[model samples]
Target: MKNTLPIALSNRHVHLSEEHIKILFGEGHELNKTKDLSQPGQYACEEKIDVVGPKNTLKGVRVLGPARKNTQIEVSLADGFTLGVVPPVRDSGDLAGSPGAKLVGPKGEVQITEGIIAAARHIHMHTADAEDFGVNDKDRVKVRVGGERGLIFENVLVRVHPEYALEMHVDVDEGNAAGVKNGDMVELIK
Candidate 1:
């Protein structure tokens, strides 16, 4: 049986470590929530920063919080080209031997050693939804999106957690190519 899941298009953004947050913002600055994201306990902060790459700089890049163990930058392939960095497609929090960039905050700037990545397209499903979809955590599957720009995306990672809401996350390039928008339903083909 095939299952359909809602899609969420993720833009280029950074998740900062607490130390980096203090350095970039201030000694005791907390990320002010701009809005709650689909994921549990995650949000877009009011703060924005500029990320400088080898060939270009990306301005107004939103910061997503609460803080991560290590800082990581997620971008699409098109975004990678714009920044002149060939980012590896990695799952979130998997930043061993990735690329790096300079992050410019309003108060300070810091150089990240290695964290930039093209986040892998994945589906976050709670236990109940996982059971419904007949999948488990870390299972790889294919997804079919129907439209004028319809396509079948392979190796879509399945992330299962009780706290995670059911949503498929893809970068801007993937979404645009598939003609998908937020709230669009995509089918999971085993």
Candidate 2:
């Protein structure tokens, strides 16, 4: 039988408001805004940057929405960098006791506001794919991602719908830790 499992890298991300963006990036730093259909009061940034987390460094994170009282930064896999570990996506306000970050530019040093690490893990599967896997929305299970950096991820929440294809979602920190990338294979580890 053919093994449908493949290793896929995952990344973490968070939502922030314009005001919080100013607090984090400082004044004059640009914040791009894009609407998100999946979440209300959610948005995506056209510009991307690097965010350092507790265990690893995350590159190409697109900030979403305007800064709110409780804004968050989303960290995703580098798509190419391999640190052999996934860095968790953290809230800016929660980075105080966690790792700090430096904006990759002439901007010099940037301070993290929060210290929370480890975003929730979830899987993305289409309605048909979900049926194929015999899983449903909110179903929790373990996924075995195979490759040089193979790993069995547990407690993965399932999100099933028509708009989604079969895929697992992870924050950048988690992706880095697990060494995941796009087109990587992931199998239900049950």
Candidate 3:
């Protein structure tokens, strides 16, 4: 079976905590869906905020919903430099000892002690898709993208879930370095 997945370029974004959402938006506020994301039941919300990093502030960062137990900020390496925080590359929901930032919203601001990160590249595969690829959850793999500017990405995490969509997620920097865009196919390198 062929082992390939479409790449999904992930830009700078924030996933708010339920407590923070109410503080930022208001009491009993909910995010509005701007568009559906590749992941099933996940959508881009209309809410946006500014994250104040150590050295600089980044504005217009979109917030994804629904809220989680804790808030997390995902940014590219370039963004980390702009904010002057060296974020560790980690999988989603793993924020131990990661960076933190100040988030400014319309209604209020949140000073987070930790939760910022440069998200590690990963592939979201359905259970059947993982079987086809011969991979398991938490496994690290390599991905090859070919073109005028080809690149091989290592340490790509494989996340397999029944509800996952078959897509590789990379930040803007990684996508630009490979000269790949959203919907570009990448072959798995065992």
Winning model by lDDT: 1
lDDT winner between candidates 1 and 2? 1
lDDT of each: 0.94, 0.55, 0.93
Candidate 2: 10-residue stretch with minimal lDDT: 78-87
Candidate 3: tens digits of C-alpha lDDT, residues 1-190: 8687899899999999999998888888989999999999888999999999889999999999778898999999899999999989898999999989899999998899899998999999999999999999999999999999998999999999999999999999999999999999889999
Off by over 4 Å in 3: none
lDDT of 2 by residue, 48-163 (tens): 55655444556666665555565444444342133223335432344435323443322333554542245457766677777777778878889877667778888877777777
lDDT of 2: 0.55
Model 2, TM vs. native: 0.52
- Distance from true position, residue 48, model 1, in Å? 0.7
Clashing pairs in 1: none
What is the Cα-based TM-score of model 1?
0.98
The per-residue C-alpha lDDT of model 1 at residue 34 equals 88
Clashing pairs in 3: none
How many pairs of residues collide in each model? 0, 38, 0
